[model samples]
Target chain A: MNEPYFREAEERFCELLKAYLPYEDAYQELYKTEVNNLPLYGYGVKGFTLSMIEAIMNITNNKGDLKLVEGALAIGREILGKPVELLEDVESTLKSLNGDYRLVMATKGDLLDQERKLLKSGLAKYFHHIEIMSNKNKEDFQKLINHLDCAPEEFMMVGNSLKSDILPVLQIGGNAVYVPYHITWEHEKIDHHITHDHFHQVETIKEILPFLKSQSYLTKETLK
Target chain B: MNEPYFREAEERFCELLKAYLPYEDAYQELYKTEVNNLPLYGYGVKGFTLSMIEAIMNITNNKGDLKLVEGALAIGREILGKPVELLEDVESTLKSLNGDYRLVMATKGDLLDQERKLLKSGLAKYFHHIEIMSNKNKEDFQKLINHLDCAPEEFMMVGNSLKSDILPVLQIGGNAVYVPYHITWEHEKIDHHITHDHFHQVETIKEILPFLKSQSYLTKETLK
Candidate 1:
């Protein structure tokens, strides 16, 4: 039930590093290198794979063993082959809200990866629009909303990441719902006390249904 | 005047193989390897870079030296750092069509790379929608038309690749204008005799202007 594939790749890297360094220290160093190489490689399995190779080069002092390169290739092949794992409530949430409100998927992901994942997730038909954003910044949200031809208040964003899907939307005056998954992406973990009229948090995607239904009711019946 | 950066990377890979094999032999082998890895790496600078490493491994019998990996790393870094080189008439073409047609960019490309290029290209202002498709198949075209709320005939695809941009669109009953870029992506080179009512081919992007203008004429004045 809990086989997150990226963790498998990370653990593989850690194991590869076991001969030279401690696990946590190696992980931190690897993460740092990946972050530093983000601009060059962008993101997704290919970038992750490339960063692993780069990290190996750094750790092994540019004399990275051929076997380690083999490991990196294996890691890349494994990650690329891994199937998309949709969150439990994601399909239900999309089904509930798809028709009533325009459902758009905005992701800062690899084009091939996200598109493949969308196909694999069996959730493509539920979305009115599927956008692969370069970054999830305030400007990106504003551009997305403007392109959608929807006002900020009328457009609501829902996702698991506060840093990406929440803050940027809120900053741009769009409504946002935070559906915290059990395992948050490390980069998206933020400690913020939010007290906004427009912001709401839920433990899972299913929990957001009530709030959305009521809010949409107000929008259709009251606002209209 | 033109330094297609990807070519530079290719040449570097070729040079690296000079010690072991003939130039053209090494080049063909690398090309074959890169094509094979397309499913694994997808299409992008990262994929190309990874394929080079894989090719090196293949060529060197998995006894690939550290210098080869270093060469691949440098190639990846160099390619990623290269700026967007907008075609000469692309801006002019968009400028001409922006007001009339609901211009949408449909690209089967790496999301981050395309987005970054779009931003740098500064032609983002012209497009009403930007779609990064996973593939350029007939079904992909149909889906895009459906999402755009337009009939296949109402949507016109303007692109350089005959394989990706022309055949698929024509197969889906969409209008297509092919502007042949001088440097055709090797994978997109297709020898097809296109004799269709909805297909038009031009040497340069600027040539598509008159066709599009006259098309919008038929769409607005004649048809409506």
Candidate 2:
């Protein structure tokens, strides 16, 4: 993110909330309320945008301020229209791993928004296919692993979020390498530590190549 | 669904518009604007809700009226929360076809919204797994067919919308059965007649059972 990504959205949303609510932690309250709305709204810009509007309404005591709604809409449109930015070494790492391994993208979010990001990233061609899920739970991983015709032990997931991409995979007997982003979503933060035989934490995308190249990634070489 | 499906939502949105503007066809205007927003917002109630809010802003000259926003959210929530009502004979016909053929569900919409509907419909157990796409175009169908390990000519799709479900499948050399719904979305309405060897039209869900039972579904037994 280089200090300029979702944190940008959060700052803008905080600014929007501050214009209406007196509390300094008003934007944080939006997160708490959104966690409650996750089951109903799920993840994505649309859900987040809706949550912002709902929070605005709640904070204003249903006053329906025209200016606040307009500001919220503008913030949402900006986030939705933001271009996809690739992490450093992502393209090179994919290029290095492309010919030897079969790659698939398993993502969870608004269908169109996820597809749009993939399309704009220009990395869609490297994947065999895209697997879109409602949530990244144990069952979702099991179903996806089954559908891909692979055993859980043989399936490896490389993603940025430990909550969605790492813990569930570890719970289901799969391999997961967590590459934490600098500007992670607060909802994805975990208070506890993870210690598993199949879990590895890496500092960047390119570091996984050495273990993968050995074809025996189960070793304790990269465990943090 | 016989009388109280999406039409109810549309009527509610129209009522919302009538309160803010003097136009008799303001909800119709919502659909027109939504068509233009499809590329950005895609399908499902979330997209529809966003389009409604955007339409209100435009119609009100960016006034962003609080009442209209609340009304739009109410209508969107109603559609999102409404239980999935099975079509007549849907359960019985699916039961009859079970175990004899590999049943699959190919759907499109918001990721969580579609999952919610499938879970609510109690039809999730009937399919091998769900296939959710952003759209139902030829490319989407072709990719799904490829994923399912079936040839285009051997694959069959049974859906309600001609523009989305039938034409795209036929265009890609696949078989399709059209079962028209009573309250068809105007956006899904087609103006042309279809005459294809791979196409069949049925009035209800159970009507396809006869040809499907014979296993020679390509035979000219049920043209109408």
Candidate 3:
């Protein structure tokens, strides 16, 4: 879900918001409200951006400022259009394990927009299958596993959001790697962190290679 | 799509809003704003309801009032969860044409939400395929036709929205029956009227029977 590059998008979204509002913590408030209301509105760059702007306009007492809101939305479109920078060593890393693992990019967002981003990301060639889910709850993960025809123990989930990436996968009896981003959405933050045998935290995505090398599932034939 | 009974759903949404804000034209304002912002926020009762509430809160200058907004969103969840009643003779009409034509339920909204409604409607038995698209435009329709392995002329689209249902099908050279609902979304209204040889307008879903019977493609073998 994080794709190792979405944090930059989030940072850019916040930068764009700063141009319209003078509030220093506008992004923080925006993230909190967007997460809280995500179940109601669902997920997408467009909906999330609109929600963020609506929150900012309300807090700043600029509710009637339609033009300002439009400006903010336009910025959101720009953010979505912005090229996603692949994290350091991401391409080479994924390419190395491409055949060794059934790399499926499971992401959730607006269908059209997410597809566009995946195309723009230029990293689509490394994965076996791509999923753009409407929601990433436990039910969604179960469906994905079923579609892949793999047992939960064989799946290795990796992403930046604890709520979307780590928790649900672990709850479904799958393995997961949590790569913490510098700036995370408040809503994705978990109050109670679980300690599990299959759950591993790494400083960077590259660390997952060594972790996988230690797994019995990684065979030399597939690694070739 | 309206599914015939969405007007009642819209009416229910408006009624819920009236409890929080005493504005006579609130629903109208809500609908207008919603249509205008549909492209930006995308569609689905949840997103639309959230946007409408955001608009009301903005106009009423109750920006920090999160509880009222939450209440409104809850109403939106109810709208999505509400049972959709088919138009008069809709099921029978569709059932009659069910085999004669490759009946595909093509509507746009949140994927999971739309699927839930389709399953709940118990109308899933009639259609050969059901598509809940992110957006209903020429390209989207083209993709659906391609997937169905049918030519544009072979497809007959029956839906309520002109913006989504009628125009695109006509533009793609598909036959279409316009079954106008009593309340149409403002965004779905077309600026210019279309007169095409393949297009027919009927007051109810039942009326489509005679129109389809007139078509040479409606053979006894296919119908049986």
The best candidate by lDDT is 2
Highest-scoring model, DockQ:
1
For candidate 3, write residues B1-224 as lDDT tens digits: 34433455556556656655555576676777676666555677645654656565555565334444544555565666676665578778877876666778887776657766787778999987677677888988998898777888778888888788888888998878888887765567888887898788988888888877787864444333
TM-score of each: 0.90, 0.91, 0.62
Candidate 2, residue B184: how far the Cα is off, in Å:
0.7
How many backbone clashes are present in model 3? Answer: 0
The DockQ ranking, best first, is 1, 2, 3
DockQ values for all predictions? Answer: 0.62, 0.56, 0.15
lDDT of 1 by residue, A160-216 (tens): 788888888889888888876666656667887777888998887887668766775
Winner on TM-score between 1 and 2 is: 2
Q: Candidate 2 chain B TM?
A: 0.91
Interface C-alpha root-mean-square deviation of candidate 3: 6.3
lDDT of 1 at A148: 76
Clash count list over all predictions: 0, 0, 0
RMSD of 2: 3.6
How well does each candidate reproduce the native contacts, as fnat? 0.61, 0.43, 0.13
What's the iRMSD of model 2? 1.7
* CAPRI rating of model 3: incorrect
